[model samples]
Target: MGSPGRSHRRLPQAPDRKTSIQEAALLPISRRQALALGGAALLAGSAGDARAASPQGQLTWAVHVSLAPTWFDPAETPGMITPFMLLYALHDAMVKPMPGQTAAPCLADAWKMAPDGLSYEFTVRKDVTFHNGEPVTAEDVKFSFERYRGTSASVMKERVAAVETPDARTVRFVLKKPWPDFLTFYSSATGAGWIVPKKYIQQVGEEGFKKAPIGAGPYKFVSFTPGVELVFEAFEGYWRKLPSVKRLVLKVIPEESTRLAALKRGEVDIAYSIRGELAEELQRTPGFTLKPVVIQGTFWLYFPEQWDPKSPWHDLRVREAAALAMDYKSINEALTLGYSRVANSIIPDSFEFFWKPPPAVYDPRQAKALLAAAGFRNGFDAGDYYCDASYANLAEAVLNNLQEVGIRVKLRPLERAAFFSAYAEKKLKNIIQAASGAFGNAATRLDAFVMKGGTYAYGHYDDLEALFAEQAVELDQKKRTELLHKIQRLVHERVIYAPIWQLAFINGQGKRVRESALGLIEGHAYSAPYEDVTINTG
Candidate 1:
């Protein structure tokens, strides 16, 4: 598939007055979406975007989604973007994502693989110290790895035969097989990379640790109010350069207008997840700057019930028809403001092993023909199309497109927690408009989303499972790359899921804040290396 070029559109002029904050929150879509349609024109005519020219002091960030203590624990964290926002602030991994690179040294200063590829050794950084004044040791690394009970833990347990510490500052992992993506697997972008103090957790217990978490990251957890706010202070004892901001406050502002209003009023240093006309307004306005990043993920449709042969979705023709109904270009223009690209396969284009198939062609006539051949010419009720409220606009757009090709679905919006919980409990029915942002190569993504017994997968295919298993242990880079390509081709040919487009996150920053280091790392959606970020004083 051909790569799509970036496009820009001028923001329409703002009106004289702003809508009431209360009214703005109740809109069908986000305040940014409403702003794109001229509902909140006050943002356009507002004052200049400039702010106090300083990089120091407290940095208050207004996040678009709410967070809870459930997400703070690295061991229990489910794969999602919101939780990682706090995780990045309060924790450090053995290896972290370097600026523009996927993996770099962190707690583990250096690492090497054995000649046989089954055993890997890491030389732990001796200077690293936790927030509580205790030096990080190899035992802490072993404990943290064993304590992990998250979605990826099963994969780790299956692949890792043992975690051995030869010395206080040296740790080694003996794998059952030669996993080709071991470095990416243990990178900070995933849960396995996060290291915690074993002594502290043992003394405080899991519940107690969540309330007052301690880590060896640049920031130390001060306090947390579930679903509302979290506070962190710069860790002076950090091995790396200390964070410029003395205090960091992550305020959970679910409403888009509230976040924007906070940024406009200079109440917050940064506001995340701003999109559509609001992003454009920030770009045109003087005091605010819009930072757009294309994350490595795709907003696609999943048919959980399709695994059952009785369901219409079980038919490939029906699934292909559903995929064909989506107009990727139109959806990208409407929702992303032309900032996103149409996804050609499950693996995002950013990955090294990403396979670019033919670009998706929108053809309602062909889609109708497929559906008719599958015995649904007039379209069948697909039941509720459930998704998190954050994706309301995208879900509605998909529903409209599907309706045009005779695949009817009603939008059922749920709170973020409820939406994720439903999927975790395997209660999701009919079609689900969901997304996956796992950071790694194509093999990592395919294993997590499509392989048998995968955390996010519901369907099972023995042949595909065999291929994935083979690729996971294949040491030859060329052979592994070819295997990954084959898996992507199978996913595309089977239409396992209807991939829509790759979504980009738009962040609004007050001019006072110069976030030079804040950007996607290994396609991480919530990456913010606070230690490197400064609130520009000039």
Candidate 2:
């Protein structure tokens, strides 16, 4: 608690059932452990009507980097929910996307898109209260959207053409055109067109507002240490029951191995999804467990359009050869301990209608033949860029795979911050990069690679501008799928991203880590996880 001022946010709390944690460990008991523990007493027992009678009730979560959201003003970045991630514990989004459930209400009890197709209305839930104890007003709900559009979020402005509040407790959005995918955008992490407190923003300008903001969620932020840590306390009056625990900490530790080691040593209680090569070992450790949950993310490579003219990769044959040469099987087994899957397509299994029904294509010898036929029989040496603390190792595994085909690889690693900034500019000199955590949407995939100015485009697909213009505006799911499927099929055929496995957004934590999922998995838009899970203390 004495680690200096941490950011403030509200978290939800719930009373623990006496046998919840035990019941959760549903595995049949063993004789040796049962006999030895038959006489041993339970460590902490009993729960009250209000809270856990004995709850360390505090949780510490670790991730590879601090929550450095690029844009807090959601309007600035199209579909970005930086504020939501920042205010996750402190506020809730209107609809939450759970593992199996369709989008359900968080702040607003229910919502409907008008028959006209351009207007969307919501019946704001009147039961919620802000951390400040004020009744959540309909005005507040309307204000969150208007406030997000403070001329700062140009991207948001472009996507959300207009907003109108026709009545108290009702907010309607009238778009320039009918968008059936409206729900998809709102549910997206970046699509959280949240209603920020208009009064608070007026009181504290932009910079001041980011330092501390308000939301109606399960936890309240207390303070933040840039690049170090964030501490949160439970919001008892959360619309949902308060979180079972009293406090939570989101600690940033960038070193992948060190983070895993920290979890093993009990230095931190929880680590978010950790997808490095060390996952299997961590799962095997006693009293600690690994839970592999499906994530809406995919990891792959990038090419700088700026440098494409100078490389042989521009030739489709060479590019395909390179893609074929990268031994995903060996890479997954050696670097990821065979815990990961080789991604043949950019669309991951979690995405709707994603058919993972067939065998993966892998042919290093064929890749060699293709490379030899491409006029450079000797193959070529290249450098790949990696920013993750542990990604260099994955890069090395890739290097080995490529090396077998007479292609030499040099691993280039940059600091996470530098790597990200460089990537944003699309100025990488070489071909090695890893991209993941794309919230599952056809548009998300299209935006990443096919958009005129996309993050993954880096310069590989030059003619994609036309495709993106149409894909971006096509609102019909079936029509959009045809386009998305064609574009992604092109992604594989073109081998623009000599794809690495689609990695889950993973982190590592210790003995007390419980939840397999976290609030941040959805990207920068939504904030509804603090009260979702019930954790009993270690």
Candidate 3:
């Protein structure tokens, strides 16, 4: 398989073909369409003799962000794509994302929902053992869920009434009410699905565990140098096939040019988040491969104090004017090379429940009129526009567009850890550029970013909050979908956020790498099923 052009290709099947057809159906194309699009060829290439005969080698992956120990701890996880880069390697979840499917059973062998939809029972796999040689038990599952302190903890606390371990192998979760998306929430796509060794954590304590963590993932933790690199070795006792690559090194190379140089010089096997002209250049290069995957995220602008009447953003006219000021077409062409789609709503257009609002009008005249009506004829300074280094280009583009409309914004870029820490602590005071590619349906995205008291939420509306709460417990799918549509409409009508475009991630892979699967879903950015990846030695 080579780098795809304008179109997307179906992901190859995982080494373990345990995924269900229902899960595979959730992808953009049907299974038949997938097979027609060279899926069989890809599958055969992944499991062929070449991969089997390849000798185990060390695979060095270069990432743009600096990783920290906090990303490895399941309890303190921030539930974003970046953290999962470490989480997927250091820890194993009860349910994990299948190669081309929604989710597949991992530590948990089977699960069933109650007739009333208020409880879920999972059959824990008895054969599974953590890296420390401790058997994974139902008690451990219960403890992991209870000890979660991440952003998703609010959803868990509100929905999960109690956890019961009837026996060593059976674990049940009693819900506060009927929730249709309960399974998706607990899937590997989110933080709630991660399972940790309870006994080990209690013995070492949370802080100590961060320093040296133990989990049931395919790779065992070797060592970590903060802001530098993380090393891991294949776990011989892993439940699945041992990783084909014996050693894995994740190096923190924040500079894109340096990472590209490392890839060309064979210092790194994989380089992540390659964009703009560099991505196009890498695609044409002989030895390098450019892999582009559509993520379930958007590059958009957020107003932190939009709800405060004292702030200029409190006026709906001003927000609408700001939205109109954005030149999405130019932004998409410049930033994404015309690969990304302009977003109409928070939910991507590809999703079934997506509300197709009209494309944003780029009417500078109307925007100026609206601004003048809102008492800012010569648009006021909108404070600083905060974003991580990775999104500096997009932020700069947004800044220029706002400047055209007379809204002055100072660009402020921070490192990955600092950016997220500030965002979580609600320290961002101005228009901020943010992205979220989390898996799950529209409701999951809404709950995570827009709902009242959400992790990244800066504004709240009581009516929308009540509707979200109602939709959570509504058993009927039709009624729940209707409520979700209403919420999306309200958000767009009120200009809650200035939706820009749905982003596609670009990655560069070297010739030495083979049999690698970069997940089938949108949120699988920077995460891969490493055990199945084979390093070519020829």
Candidate 4:
């Protein structure tokens, strides 16, 4: 399939029942359906007409989080999907998840996996060039992979024995063993496959590169004001298509009200992460589009203290009680305006080899009993509940529920980056409302959160780790699926996590915007395919 321009309107298949988030949460896409969602390759035939289209206007975004320089560099991806917002504009990936497809070809025109599953090769697009006019080659791909120090880097490096540049346009990856999720990890899940200019990075040191990063994407970096905004200009020579908007500006607006105000006053073309009353107001207001993007991200309560034998959370009854205490349905209705799907597991239902667990049972009485059984008849001090500051409201709601069930905790909200940093460093204690919006299937999710030595994992279980290891090398699809499902079942049965729900992020678009690229990519919360974004000047 050819690379889709702004006019491309094909969307992924939705749940059979359109009734509610609760009803839809029970239905899981079959393995066949999940496999069918594989992305398409871009054809040069589509590029001619797309490149010929003249660029115009400017698009501004009132982003919910503060802009970080780390996001500008794909090699430093935090293992989450948020960085993709900037990476999509400033850089291009060999294989990327696009609208209507999960692993669409971008920098690499075509790629093939060896029959033995030990090697993979990609044919780089010859027409592709960085913003600095340097052609992307196999060497650059190798260099980028070698230099990747982001999330999952250690595992990627361990699994891949060598990266070979057979020709200028051909890059081959020879794995130490048959790792089935190689593409999912390298391409869709992490930024390891996102190509950067080899010659330019070598010339400019890492810090200098961050100051003025360049790429082969549709938009080129123009200027950046720390904690204020980022500016970009369209790169006409982009391999995919010339960006419809000539200028792109991303302004940091941490407050939801301020973002909404900016959108209402026409200060910004798009505003992200509008929730609760603000979201409702946006939906009711005229001349505005309130888009609820059903992202692949799932919010869950993580008990870092659970692994500690001396901690109260270590008791099975305590963990079970926490899971039972959550009123997820009410939270979904109140916060997401009933648009978010109530999740039973962190692994998204749309992913390959997904196992749909039973619907969550909200039983406050049972929760109280479990706490009593665990020797906490009058409740226990669960210390602080750490969460992303932007989702403090959700955390507050969770805390309220936990309070009622005798699992008392204080709310400790931190900035997004700070929270991740603290969590990664294992400095955080007590409860953590964690989430993952990164792309990939179930095994990848387990590797990061459940398996030992993961980027964000606090602890691991021996049995689950064994299962994970077994699935990693299992070449048979049927056997692998069974092993993965068993692992998820173990997690569910043990109540390792108190799942909240799959997020349905609310965003606003102004009347000036024609195509915001909102909901263009399945499970991506932000407006994307920045090249396809257009405006209505008339």
Q: Count the backbone clashes (under 3 Å) in each candidate.
A: 10, 53, 0, 0
Q: Write the per-residue lDDT of candidate 3 for residues 1-538, one digit (tens) a residue.
A: 1111123232343422233233434433323222223222333234323323322678999988888788888777663667777776777777655454455556765566676677878877658889989999999899988888877688877889999999999888999887767776777436776899999998999898988889888888999998789999887766655668888999999988888889989999999878787777787889888877777667678898899989999999999988998888887776567777786677766554567788877877888899999999998999899998878888888888888888899999998778888988899988888877666667777877899778888878999999999988776657877998999999999888888888877788998987556644435776477777787667
Please give, for residues 158-188, the per-residue lDDT of candidate 2 as tens digits: 5667667677666767777765445555644
- Measured against the true structure, the TM-scores of the candidates, in listed sequence, are 0.87, 0.77, 0.89, 0.92
Which candidate tops lDDT? 4
Best by TM-score: 4
* lDDT (Cα, tens digit) per residue for candidate 1, span 187-304: 6335877889999999999999988889888888888787688888888766656567788888888887788888999988888888766777777888778877788767788888
- lDDT tens digits by residue: candidate 4, 509-536: 9999999999888888788889879989
Error of 2 at 128 (Å): 2.6
Q: What is the lDDT of residue 92 in candidate 1?
A: 84
lDDT of 1: 0.74
Ranking by TM-score: 4, 3, 1, 2
State, as a TM-score between 0 and 1, how close model 4 is to the true structure: 0.92
